[model samples]
Every structure is written in structure tokens, then in C-alpha cells.
Target chain A: MKTKFTRPERRLLAASCAVPITAALCTNAGAMHIMEGFLPQGHAIAWGAVCLPFVVWGLIAMRKIVAQHRKAVLLLAMMGAYAFVLSALKRPSVTGSSSHPTGTGLGAVLFGPAPMAVLGMIVLLFQAILLAHGGLTTLGANTFSMAIAGPFVSFGVYRLCRKLKVNRLVSVGIACALGDLFTYCITAAQLALAHPGEQGVLASMAEFLGVFALTQIPLAIVEGILSAIVLMMLESFAKPELREIGFLQKEVVKA
Target chain B: MSKKQVVTILILVLLCAAILIFPLMTIRDSEFGGADGQAEEVIAQIDPDYTPWAENILEPPGGETESLLFCLQTALGAIVIGFGFGYLVARKKYRAEEAV
Candidate 1:
């Protein structure tokens, strides 16, 4: 860290963080991706099949990162833990609408979308089995939306912003926010397809979108800002690790 | 933490508070519910006959148990990130001293 925190300062930081976390605990676990056994059998199987290739790719990518970068092992663990923390912290928003942040965006930005596939799959698996939240049957569909779709969006936004030479934090924030928004969009689409409304699939999608997208906008921004703060912390204390991981090239992050 | 980072973090805390509280203030008679359930409601609206056939092999006993498991997930996550960060910071600090 650039500065060592005093006892009081640490307390203040913890107190500030405690507010949202405590609120999260009080809220119902409602905003998780398509719940247990929600999808029809064929749709469920299809979604799972679709996610198979990505999960395999992610396993390979993660193994490569672990085998190649001993120093970066800690970074990898931090990223996984970060995804666990954020997804578990569901935020309630406007008009009693509640949703959760997919912390995968930060990992996608730091590493790449590929490794996030494995981490996200594991998180969803645990949520399904232990919490009885998002179901095992719908795992494939949920994984596709939260893991593959979200991370890809984040990685794309991040790469685009970096290519444009935008400020580092801005890149991280925009990428993560958009990535978070996209996850729900896919979820809405998945639900729409499974149960098309009277008007049609498009109408059904719009209905699902209406429920999720509006509330997600602000939550997405919140995820973005929080992610940028984490990146800032990493840069301060884990400069060597970041550099070794090729996240901070000689002038890439320099203002 | 550095002054800039601390300030940024505090701003985040305040912003999150606003996001959570604004709805309660503006919208009345709102049942703050989960989006997943809302989506399911939409599904029911579309296909009234359809019922979710698959079941969780191990359902958490109740909402409380579910909450407990969620909290456990959070705790495990916190510990991993905390230990990873502490180790990295300590390695940097002590390694700097050794180089000096």
C-alpha cells in the first residue's frame, strides 16, 4: 500500500463497507440468475451444452496462467475471491427491485474472459448446491449468461478502451459496468426464449428486459466504481505482480 | 491507503447508499423482491401450465439456512482475498527492506 492505515482509519473503512454488506444480508436472495429448475428440460440441456466448450477453454487458460506465473498465483486467488464476494452481495435498487453484481468483470479486465469461465462456473455450482439458489439443472444457461457473456463484454470493452488510450481507471469502470449490464441482458433473453409471451419472443424478451435492465443500470455503475477501486489498490501494493502479469506495461497505465 | 484511494472508496460507499435508499424514499408500497422471482412471474404469465420440473438435490433448509450459506460463501471469499493481499503486501514490504 502507498500508505499504512492507522487503526482509526481502518475502522472507518470497515464501517463504511459494512453498511452495504449488512444491507445485502438483510435483503432476500432474489436477484440470482434463473432459479432452480426454472428452465424447461430441452432449454436447460441446450444451455448447458452451449457452455461446455467455454468451460473447457477456461480450464486450459487457467492452467496455463497457474503453470507459467508463480508470482501471479495470489492475483488469481484474489480475483476468484472477488467474484465470490460480489456475486454474493446482491444489491436492492429502485422500486423494490433487487439484483447482484457479477464480480467476474474485474477478473476479465485483470486476466481475460477465458479464466473467468472456470471461476464463474464454480461459483454458480456452489450457489446451486449449497445455497439452493440458482439450480443445478439450469447451471449451463446460468453459466453462459453470467460467466461467458459478461466476461466477454468486459474484456471487449476493456481492450477497446485501452486501445483508445483512455485513462486506466475509466477503462476498468466502463468495461465492468457494461459487462455487468450485459449479463442481465442475456438472462432476460434466455428467459424470453424459454417462455415466449403471448405477443412473441421479442415481446417476452422486452418484458424480461423491462424487469431487469432498469434496476441494473445503477447497480452496474456501482460495480464499475467498486472494481476501479480494487484495481487501484492492486496497482499500489501489487505493482510487481501486475507488471509481471502484463497488465501494466511500461507506459500502458501511465497518465 | 493513500488519500486519493480512501477518498474514492468513501465516495463509493456514499454512492452505494444512495442507490439502495433512493427507491425507498421515492417509491411507496413497493415490495422489494428478487428479479429472479419477478422473471419467474413473467414466465407464469406467459405459460400458466408450465411448471419447473427439476429440483435442487440439496435445498437449504429455509431462507435462514440459505442466508447462512451465502454468508459462508462471503466469508470464505473474504479470507482468500485478505490472505492473498496481506501476503503480497508483506512480501513487498519485507523484500524492499532486504534490498535496502
Candidate 2:
């Protein structure tokens, strides 16, 4: 078995993690678009209230994953931190809806969903405490939509692709698009569930989906291509190490 | 199975259950609480001209008090469905590897 990441590549991975964290902290919508006061105080409080155990459970899970993949954990944590900060940054809209990236799919595909949930809770807590982007009540709802759902979808797609023997780039791109779309779909569902009386929930959801598709689709494609590029580069440049991490197929490499 | 494989599988299953089930167990009932449902009632009580189209979109039907039982029931159904799909994929992957 060989290692995957070259020394420089390891540094790059580490850097990728840190970059998102800083971006998340600085930009309200670094990856997710959260509008102003979209979730009510009561809603935020309710979700935030549910977020408590999730945070605790996430911390426990993170500790376990870190024991096995210290560097990966650090990088993933940074990404989660970045997501948190960005989630806190709010944009005002006439539509009275705030949206944010459900990074769960991306995170789950990379690091698995359990730790991603922890990462999301941390990010949400930070955003609520420091930036006040979202309310304390709505943390659970946000976590469920973004952190939990996103990653699980991505992971599922990736595994299915691997089994199907699809081209690596195609697999990643498809996963990215689906993952992002699912996040939005889940958010729409949540909104619907949260406020069924809103006769326009379906219409607004459709409208939001239409508006979001304009940018998100392309963004998903870009992200997918980038991830595939990085992973493929790793396959050639750092296959031996990545193989050890169970990301690459041992059979693919001609011994 | 190797220890690593066993550990990985165990964790994977646990995470899947958490992602698919926890939401159902802990999900709040009144997400639509105090927003649209009440607004509609108020509109109906007051304006009488309000159609469903103009009513606030965030509130629930029958008032702000959400049916926690309903959310949990629906969540349970969703989890079962999600798990079935996940299992199908996992089984497919396993079979493919066996063939190869």
C-alpha cells in the first residue's frame, strides 16, 4: 500500500481548509446565501435548542475521527469553521427568505456525515454567538438541512459512482450538482413544513429554485471539476499515500 | 473481516442511522408556528378578502401549534425510504466489487 498526498499537496489540503474558514468568517454568503431575519426568533431558538445535543454528539464523533485521521480532521474542521462564519453573514432581500449552502453533502462525501454534523453545529454556534447571522433557536433546522443532509447525499452519490465505475470527474461533478440541489430541495421542504399556511411556499420554493439554479448549478459543476482535478492529481502524484487512506482503488494502480 | 473494515462499516452504519433517524426523533413540531397560520386566521377574521395566495407563506395550517406527531411520523417514513435507497446502493457496490 502506498501513500496519497505529497508533502506539498498535504500543505495545499491544509491551506484549502483554512481558506474556507477565513472566507466563511468574512463573507455572509461565502457558500450559502442566508437572507436577513429569514428564520424567526422562535424558529432560531427552537433549532438552536436542538443543536445542543448535536454539538455534543458531533464533538464526540470528531474526537473519534481525529484519532484516525488527524490531518484530515484538522482540514475538515477548518472547512466547517469557514462554513459557520459565512452562514452568519446575512443578505437582505425583499422576498423575506434567507438561504445558505448545505455543506453536508460535500463534507459527507469527503469526510463522512457524522463529523460534518459536528462541524456544522460549531459553525452555527459561532455564527449565532459572534456574528448573529442566524438565531439561537434555528440551529437544529439549519444543521439538518445543510450539514446533515448535504454530506449524506454526496457520500451516497460518490459510493454509487464508484460502484458503477463512472469516470472520476463525472462522478464528482454529478455528486456536486445533486448534493447542492438536494440541499436546496430540503430547505424548501423545511420551509414548507415550517409554514404550510404560506400558500406560496410551493411557488416561492419553485421561484427560489429557479433563481438559485442560475448560479448554483455552475458553481456545483465548478466545485465538482475542481475536486476531481485535485483527487486525480493526487492519484498520479500521491497515489501511494491516498491508497492507504482508502480513497483510491488499489487495483487501479498497476503494480 | 479486518478490524479496519469492521470499524469503517460500523461507523458508516451508525452515521447513516443518525442522519436518517435523528431528525425524525428530535424534529420540532411548530416550525410553521406563529407565522402564516395565525396570519391567515387574522386575515380571515379581519380583512375577509385574503385569498390563500396573499397569505404569509411561513405559517402552518390550523394555527402555530405544529403536529409534532405528524412531523415525527413523516420523518419516520422518510428515514425508512432513505435507508432502503442507501442499502440498495451499498449492496450494488458490494456486488460489483465481488464480480470484478
Candidate 3:
């Protein structure tokens, strides 16, 4: 088999390979977002039901992207892998919550939040079934928090930053960081609702948020920076593909 | 380096430093845990009678082995997905060129 890759393509491949290895080295073993069977059956079912519509919409959006731009098929898959690897790289934080980059921000920015719905769900499923990181029953709750909520925040923040005419890389960083923080907030809310203290759901939510903030804030900043770096690499090496996927405007690519 | 490159580097360094320093300064002895475990603990504290409605289908033998399996799974998934996407994209690019 004669496979000739362009210089940029080769570099992209090398970078992609290096990312997971380095991330693995940096990771620590810890519990993730919501463990298996953590949520009550009603909450889990309700959350899963909530995610169904988004997942369906995501499937439609992904299909359209694939049909319109054949080149994007691979990028979508790579985005899924990137999210998996990044989320798995857990850094111990001052708070009990082990911290890691959500990695949804980049995908949401590149592919839009809809496609991320599908990608995130798949990643969660793999984590649950293969690594035992999450549980099948709690899949819905995890998916709702990490996949659905995180991506939407990321996409929204990116759009908002662009509207404000922020620096592209800085915008990406902020969006990713905000998205990470938002995911934890939602997770806290979910946990509080499921198991409200004597003080009530509002009080419990506040407690969870406070506990998470000690770790999540710094983690979010790290995630934002990492996502910006990844985006910069893509802009440099995968400009053509980014243009094809409509992530980079033609004028910007030309410049 | 370009201004953008310099800014990017600076941000990365500052964030890395903050992540490392904050933990050392505030809570040097805190046992880092996952949100899930912490949530579970809080739930227990809040309502001792609360019982989990579900259980994991399988539990890993130990924490070290569990981490090993997770690392393996993630690495394998990354390679397969990455290669598959790369192949598809390369094929599309090649086919387009061949037609032209």
C-alpha cells in the first residue's frame, strides 16, 4: 500500500498520536462525573428521556454534515476520540472531585453542538461499558450533564465571543473553560436534586457547587487553554479541512 | 513568535502554574476524589437512609487494575477512531484530486 501524506497531514497525525500518550501519562485513576447507579431511577430515566431528542437531532445534523462534506466524516470521528482521551486524563484537584478537561468545547465549536450530542453520548457509553467509569443506569444523567449541557454552553460561548469580536484563540479558550464549569454546575444540580439535604434542594445544590468550585475552576482554565492549543494546531495544519467543514471562514483561511 | 503565539504560550504557562499552585496552597492534604464519589459521600451525609437504586454490572478487582483497563480502552478507542477518520478524509481528498 502506497500512502503519501502531505507534510501538514503527517504532522497532524504525529500530534494526534502524541496527545493521547502524553495525556495518559498525566492522568490519575479516579471516579468520574456520576458513577454507575448513582442517580435514582426516576431521575436517570427523566434525564435519558431529555437526552433522546437531542441525540436524535444530533444524528440528523451529523448525517447532513457527512452528506454535504465528505471530508468532515473523519474529523467528526477524531473529535469523538479527542473527547474520550481528554476526559480520561484526570488531574487530582484540591477538592474531592478529580478534574479533567471536558473536551466538548472544541468539538461543539467545530461541528456545532448537535453533532457533539451524538459524539458525547458514544464516549459516555464506551466509558460506562468498557472502563466501568460510569454506569449504564446512570448513563442518562451523565450524558445529560457532560454531552448535552456542556456542548451547548461551549457553542453558545463561542458564538457569543465571536459576536464580541474577541481574539479567536482567546474566544476558544474562554468558551471551553466556561463550558467545563457549566458541566460541573449542572452535575451538581443533578446530584442535589437527586439527594436533597434537610436544608432542601437549593441548599444541597449550593453545597455541591461550593465543593466542586475548589477543583473545577482551575480545571476549567486548564481545559480552556488546552482546547485553544488544539484549535491553533488545527488552524495551522488542518486549515483546508477546517475550511471545508465551515469551521474556518474562507477569507480567514486565505489570509 | 507572533503575538498570538506568545499570548497562547503565556496563557498555557499561567494556567498550568495556577493548577499546580492552588492545590498546594489551599488544601495540601485533601484526598482528591471524583465528583461522583464526593456526591455519594454528600448524599450519605445529607440523608443516611437514602439507598442507591442501581448497582454496577461489573466491578474491577482493584483501583490500579481499573485504571489500567480504562487507559487501555481509551488508547485503543483513540487509535481506531483516529485511523478510521483519517482514512476517510484522505480518501475523499484523493478522490477529489483524481477527478480533477
- For DockQ, the strongest prediction is 1
Per-prediction TM-score: 0.87, 0.50, 0.80
Q: Could you tell me which 10 consecutive residues in candidate 3 chain B have the lowest summed lDDT?
A: B91-100
Query: Mind giving the per-residue lDDT tens digits that candidate 3 earns over A6-115?
Result: 56645654554453344433221111277776777666766776666566667667767777778777677778877887788777676645766677878898888878
User: Residue-wise lDDT of candidate 2 within A151-236, one digit each (tens)?
Assistant: 66877898788678887656765675577667656555554444444455676455445444433443344345434443443333
Candidate structures ordered by DockQ, highest first: 1, 3, 2
TM-score of model 2 vs. true structure = 0.50
Candidate 1 is scored at a TM of 0.87
Superposed by TM-score, candidate 2 places the C-alpha of residue A1 at a distance from the truth, in angstroms, of 18
**Candidate 3 ranges beyond 4 A from true positions:** A1-32, A250-255, B1-18, B21-27, B77-100
- The Cα error of candidate 3 at residue B41, in Å, is 0.7
For each of the candidates, the C-alpha root-mean-square deviation to the true structure, in angstroms, is 11.9, 18.4, 11.3
Candidate that beats the other on DockQ, 1 or 2, i.e. the better one: 1
Regions of candidate 2 where Cα sits further than 4 Å from its true position: A1-37, A40-57, A74-104, A198-204, A207-215, A233-241, A249-255, B1-100
Across B1-100, the per-residue lDDT of candidate 1 in tens digits comes to 5798888888887887787778778878777777887887888898788888877779877888888988999999999999988886787677875222
Best by the TM-score measure: 1
What would the per-residue lDDT of candidate 3 be over residues B1-100, giving only the tens digit for each residue?
A: 2588768677787877688567767776666667666767887888788886666666777888789877975796579656864654465566665322
Q: Which runs in model 1 stand beyond 4 Å of their true positions?
A: A1-32, A250-255, B97-100
- For residues A1-255, what per-residue lDDT tens digits would candidate 1 score against the true structure? 012345664565455445434443321111138988778776776677666656666766676677777778789889999999988987778737788888999998888887888899889988888877788878878888888999999989988997898888999999999999999999999988988857799999999999888779888998998899889878878887787677886446554
C-alpha lDDT of residue B40 in model 3: 75
